[model samples]
Target: MDDLVTLWPSAREASEAEDVPRRVMITGSEGYIGSVLVAKLLDGGFDVVGLDTGYYRAGWLYNDGKDRPRLLARDVRSLCAEDFEGIDAVVHLAELSNDPLGAHDVRNTYEINHRASVAIACNAKLSGVRRFVYTSSCSVYGAAGDDMVNEESTPRPQTAYARCKTLVERDLMRLADVDFSPTFLRNATAFGVSPRMRFDIVLNNLAGLAWTTRRIAMTSDGRPWRPIVHVEDICDAIQATLNAPRGAVAGEIFNVGTDSNNYRVSEIADAVAQVFPESEITFGDTAGDNRSYRVSFEKIRRHLPGFRCAWDVHRGARQLRALFEHVGLTEEMFLAPPYTRLRELRRLVESRQIDSDFRWRCHDFS
Candidate 1:
């Protein structure tokens, strides 16, 4: 922790010595969304710094040949105010991502997802960072049925992960002030190809199943509504939030996705089938996972006028199919441990690479 904090003191001095470009720090910079967001911010002419614990670093699906930012290979829980001193904004995405991973150990989930995230926001505020973009989830509206839930809707989180997102949003709102403006972007379910690919998400998982085995075997009846947005679109929302005026975004919670992007589980499967026509599809009678919600993204469209979703589910499906065909994806590759968050974390804990608390036992885990 000291070593990581010490490295940023020189960065602070350099920023104080002269005017610099807008410096934005992203936690979980090496993960699925962070990788894409880092590239987007760089292309937009922002000085980017990334911090990731490198849990999913082993999973590189494909290289996009984009320049990456200077990454700090450190845990979010170990960060302090000094680490964020020179940063103008902090995009917090470093957490145990998704539901099953959170269910694997509920205690650890709250520790990192809720408590540690709040701590990081507090640190960022203390260090004089002006803008904070928190990558929240639409899953906070869990089990809303057919009724479209918006930012004002009461959150009925059904999992540790979703619950923690709510907790962080609540806690961080208290840290918001005239100087520290925190924006909460409750992003829709993310799908689309990335260098650090994840097959655990609904659309991505279905696409992977369709590609590898030519079969999408569903465990549920596929009746629940899910609002999903492309990975790139999620990045676009983050960029928009960063560039938007502080008064417009501060203490605001915007669901990130378009109104038309919400689809029933069965529809998502059908879209994937269209991309891979040879794939067989089946669904069970039971609702396997209870978490489901249809989110209204009108607030973001109204608040951030420049933000718009560029990729829909169909386009995102085609993108995945193209990448899969280009890479010649096989069943083994699709079922790889790192592509799924729960599987990879379990492997680490069982192999003693990371301890019970999810800390790396050694620096040479790779």
Candidate 2:
């Protein structure tokens, strides 16, 4: 780790002329948030390069007609320093994205999310890629009730996915010297329409249920505190991190999303019910999943002046409702394997498209 940290220029030396990054590389550019972030960076006048393993390529919800960046169809696990050559910054988002997906295979989760991620960061630093914005999750504060947790609070990761996040953050921060600045954005649960629309997340799933069956039948008591933000707002936070001075963001952990956006699972359901008025809501008495947390996003607002959530739960739900009507979303579309990460991966494994280690078979690669 020390040997890798010494490869980059001193932070003090680099900070003298830290202009906004002009060339950026976004890993997982074909995934849910990556799809939206690619357009955002392109529109903002940055030269963007995208890299993804194309696991979820089968899912394209709608055509937004926006111009896309140059994409490298490659796995993050196989990336080396040469791939980051000439790249000024990296927004790393590729991994088993959520708690359930992480639980699908715990060993593979650590391999991809923790080990591969740290390897990429080391490669980035070695290649003199100064700015690294890592997308972490607020899920690290697992099971922390009522009281809001901040970046300084101790993380109690409940699942393999969340544990990988904390582990990656820990290892990456050790590499943060005067030369390489790595900022961790602990994003709230993400929702909103994308070309790679996901029905696995809370808001989108509830809206899909409402559109398809006109009912939200929750198996749990719906009492867990969950904070959600629009997918676009997450992109906004990334932009802010990349544009900020090295000193302001280096080795920093900021919880992305507004404080007001935090909501109990029942409250989120209520908001969804309001958007799709025809949907009937029902809940079971038991708390089925123990992963729950209310996060404080005050540090991001205080530090990154440009960062703020534009959409709340109600507005995001309304956006999903509009999208459902526009696309004429059907039950089959909502339940498609590609829209849900774990389902698509399972399908790939079962069909021999990808190996048990999640690598694509050579013949299956286009």
Candidate 3:
């Protein structure tokens, strides 16, 4: 918060246009998903303002350009009403992204993901912000078995990450009314390439391992079903939620991604194998792994006509393959701490770059 003093103005002083707002404030704007979404919003004719703590700033695979939106280096927990003064919409993407990262500290998961998110929404609503697009995860569907779960499905959250998503969704729905329309987008497992590329995801990890080690090995039996959407499609969905009319999106929870994009773990491994023909794959035991869900994405499809998923697993795998080849990716880089969120956060804390509360020790850390 102190670092933001010199870099960013107070939200009241920051607004260039007060009457009309083509302005959007995106939290975690430098993240794997946020980095891509910021560019999309900019291209879509919005005056974008980014807020991020730069937790994953070290996770660079390559530079797509040094260019970034006007960003505030601040944590979401510290954000006040002054931060949302002229913001038209707030796309909340900051959180302990996945299950393992959420598990690292359950209290932090509830604190940052659930409690902090609700605080931001309340502040946004209090500040007269029109919309709040929350990036919830499909992992909340936990173990829905072979049945395709929809927005109304009973969520059996298996991890702290999933539970926090459910909590935020429930609380945000309660906040929605005539003034503030909060849209909860439960995104499927995200894939595809970005500047801050992550190898912890199923598709990206499998493809990167194949490219670097020429081998794909699964710890689980590869039997659990997962719905996946490309990173760009997710950005499109966020943009759609941002631009939609108030009445249409008010208190709505839409599952992002496509119904056709669902695949088992083994199928993703097979797709990776196809992309890298020389790679070998090994399937492990599936007895104990209970996480499996096939999500129904019809709600988002029907609601947001402008949104469409362009890339499938095969296309995304090929994209990752091209990226790995271009960067000369190696086994060491594949297993590096930066590319994985939990590993990188652990490294940052252990090295004293950030404290246990996730606040940076110095501006140099950003």
lDDT of each model, Cα atoms only? Answer: 0.88, 0.89, 0.87
Measured by lDDT, the strongest candidate is 2
> How well is each residue in 245-272 modelled by candidate 1, as lDDT tens digits?
5677889999999999999989999999
Cα TM-score of candidate 2: 0.94
lDDT by residue (tens digit), candidate 3, 202-275? 99989988988888988688989989999999998887666555566779999999988999999999999999
Model 3 Cα shift for residue 188 (angstroms)? 0.3
Deviation (Å) of 351 in candidate 3: 0.9
lDDT of 2: 0.89
Local error of candidate 3 at 1, Å? Answer: 44
Question: Total clashing residue pairs per candidate?
Answer: 0, 3, 0
Clashes of 1: 0
Residue-level lDDT tens digits of model 2 in 264-320: 888988999998888899886754478779999989987876667899988888888
Better TM-score candidate (1, 2): 2
Candidate 2 ranges with C-alpha deviation above 4 Å: 1-17, 285-288, 364-366
Rank by lDDT, highest first.
2, 1, 3
Give the lowest summed-lDDT range of ten residues in model 1.
Answer: 1-10
TM-scores of the candidates in the order shown:
0.93, 0.94, 0.92
TM-score winner, 2 or 3: 2
